[model samples]
Target: MLISVIIPCYNSEKTIAEVVSLVIEEIGKMKGYESEIILVNDFSSDNTFDVIRDLCDKYSSVKGIDLTRNFGQHNVLMTALHYTKGDIIVGMDDDLQTHPSQIPILVRKLNEGYDLVYGKYPKKKQSFFRNLGSKFNDFTVRKLLKKPKGLVASSFWAARKLVRDEVIKCKNYNVHLQGLFLRTTKRICNVDIEHRERKVGKSGYTLRKLLRLWASCINFSIVPLRLSMLVGFIFASLGIISSLIIVIRKLVFNNIYLGWSSIMAALFLFFGVVLMVLGLIGEYIGRIFLCINNQPQFVIREMINVEEE
Candidate 1:
């Protein structure tokens, strides 16, 4: 079984080189399965590409993929998955937080017949709000996608090559990797592993970005959409009931009075609800347009100094 260790890099210069070295040193102990380390530089404005190139020159099994621009961590991982030629593939971030030492644990779990083995953290050492928000996202994902109730970290996981292929074939291009795992594979297990705070540099995921991810997770659910339709129906019903009350008040009870403020307020509230529904519809439409475009998830503008043996 060939093992491909795929790490996606985006300006991870501070700690990236150490991660590469650690994976190379640790994976060298495993026998029979040839190992390949694929580092994809996501157009790092820093010296990320240069570091990858240097590593490639130093190690025969090390390879580098240079994307044209930053296509996000998930997109680059998928791109590497497309190019992976391994019996079993392991994926992780270039950040040191997802330790390379745990790769063997995940791979061993995969070998025990599980299609997917994720490395859940012992305790995430993120800021309070980040941790809280991430937990909320995970909660919604579990409720909506019916994914396993595992403490899933977006950091490390291993899967059989077939699982990789199935996930890649998914049509949804928003590219939530863990969700794709749930969507494609039935045999999934998460093992508790070491989780370290970032040794250097701030996290790429900000509060806004986490919330956006939360939105995507919820957006993918039928329940939110069903709820939207339910709310719309309620709103429509309310509008009808309100109009009836106004007419009855004026014609039968003579209690209707002209108050421009109330009328304008109702109009604004109704229109606001309409606009919100439209916004949700627009999000789905935008995703559809992106798929129709069928653009490459990550464009490798150039590969640098690649050599085997």
Candidate 2:
């Protein structure tokens, strides 16, 4: 069986070569299993692609792709999936955090009749803010994507080629791999693994980028839009109830006065809710517009040791 390992490289020129070597070494230890490495450089501002090219030259089974721009990690993964030719596909990070040593655990779990296997960290080795962001993302996926309970999803995961084929069918501008995975199959399991500390630069994800990635979940679910409607209904009911109370008080006590501050506060609260709901609706429409315009998920700049089909 051939196992293809897909990695999305950012500015990881320092760590990628070692990562590839370790991946090769680990797969070499697996009996009856061959290995292929697919590295997609997500338009890193460093010499990341050059390192990937060198690895491709050194290893016959290694493939490299260069993106025209930084198309986010998930998009880059989708691009790599198009060129994968392995029976099983494994995805890991460019940074050593997802560690190559844990690949066998996911692959072994996958052989247990599961379509997908995620390498869940027993204890993540990320900063406080990154952990917080991950928690929020996990919650979002569980609720919005209908992810199976207790099935943890992470960067380090293995899936069958059928799952990969289904995932790559998603041509939307926004790519959320977990959502796509859940949509593809429910035969998913998680294996506990160690998340190593980063020995190179910090994470490429910023606060803004994290939020944008979270927003991509909208492509797979309408829960956010439904929540917006629910919130609007609740606020509208509150407005009606408050107005009734004010009218009753005015009728019962003629000397009672409605303060300008209270009226302004009510107006501000209702208007804020109204604008928020509008903005959420606008976001949905904007994404639809982009999809309808045929937005490209990713544009490949170059490829090494990969053939276009």
The candidate that wins on TM-score is 2
Q: Which residues of candidate 2, in runs, are more than 4 Å off?
A: none
Q: Against the true structure, whose lDDT is highest?
A: 2
Q: Residue pairs in steric clash, candidate 1?
A: none
TM-score of 1: 0.88
TM-score of every candidate relative to the true structure: 0.88, 0.98
Error of 1 at 241 (Å): 4.1
What candidate 1 gets wrong by more than 4 Å, as runs, is 31-33, 150-153, 170-173, 211-223, 241-258, 304-309
Quote the positional error of residue 166 for candidate 2 in Å: 0.9
Q: Give the CA lDDT, 0 to 100, for residue 288 in model 2.
A: 92
Over 169-242, each residue of candidate 1 has an lDDT whose tens digit, in order, gives 86555777767777777888888888887888887776666666566654356776676799889999999998
Q: Against the hidden true structure, what lDDT does model 2 obtain?
A: 0.92
How high a TM-score does candidate 2 get? 0.98
Q: What is the C-alpha lDDT profile of model 2 across 1-309, one tens digit per residue?
A: 999999999999999999999999999999999999999999899999989999999999999999999899999999999999999999999889999998889888999999999998989988887888888888878999898777778889999999998999888989988889988899999899999999998999988998988889888899988999999899889889988998999999999998999989988998998899899899989999999999999999899999889
lDDT of 2 at 285: 95
